[model samples]
Target: MPQKGSRLTPEQVGLIRAWIDQGLQWEEGATFAKAPVLNLSPRRPELPGDEGGHSVDRILASYFARYGVKTSRVGFWIDFLLDACISTRLACCRQ
Candidate 1:
């Protein structure tokens, strides 16, 4: 087949055809481009102090006030935990 202004060899064509016949199985973690080096180190973020209730609430107080987003710490944690659980379940199901 013609590729990048050049024709593929007969052997290359045969190999491609065989790959297609075999359901186009790709090698695990295989990539055409170089994968980026990620720093997977644990990080401890500086959270706001318990001056206005929860640390998250204290951090988001200005945001809540600005946007008129009325919510409780209990509600926030429940939603966050539920979302985390669902995400964890989905990830486990995929594996």
Candidate 2:
């Protein structure tokens, strides 16, 4: 049968053909049927908040402490505001 857009290599195709030629033997008690379906419903996961701060900050606390990187909400807001102002000034200048 023609398999359009197949990604199998020549060696892999050869192996498959050999297997088919050899009567397609299977291990005892093994079947190729699909396994039972799992419950895939969406659910909110409990975010880790060990330090009583923002979930993200608490999660990254270990990383920050390990790398000696200090973090503060005030510093974050200041950097964000500065970046916004710079972007606005550049856009206005380009107009």
Candidate 3:
């Protein structure tokens, strides 16, 4: 009594799980490198306007004014720096 154009039910999901458990090896190799690792510094913090409508710049400015340390490249500095690191030629497993 299967309905046409219906979503997968719990039993069907369990069957899929069983199939995966029985040696359903997924293809791997080079697909995992798409996302970049965020090696963030302690100086950078979770900014305001971060999906909660908080102003990141204002918060950073206030913090900088308090500590008297100028905030440079508030938003894009991390990404730009990380991108450079990725593109640079470094030693890779010289063994």
Q: After superposing candidate 2, which stretches have Cα over 4 Å from the reference?
A: 1-18, 26-31, 39-50, 74-95
In Å, residue 49's CA in model 2 sits off its true spot by 5.5
TM-score of each: 0.36, 0.40, 0.26
Candidate 1 vs 2: which has more TM-score: 2
| Deviation of model 1 at 75, angstroms | 5.3
Off by over 4 Å in 3: 1-59, 89-95
Itemize residue pairs with steric clashes in candidate 3: 48-54, 49-54
lDDT of each: 0.80, 0.79, 0.66
Q: Report the Cα lDDT for residue 71, model 2.
A: 72
Residues 3-91, model 2: lDDT tens digits = 77878899999999999999999899789889989999999777565557655666677778889987774346657888999999999
Candidate 1 yields a Cα-based lDDT of: 0.80
Better of 1 and 3 by TM-score: 1
Candidate 3 lDDT over 9-78, as tens digits, reads: 8999998899889887656763646687797757765665444322545567667777998755565665
Candidate with better TM-score, 2 vs 3: 2
Question: Per-prediction RMSD in angstroms?
Answer: 12.1, 7.3, 17.2
Give me candidate 2's TM-score against the actual structure.
Answer: 0.40
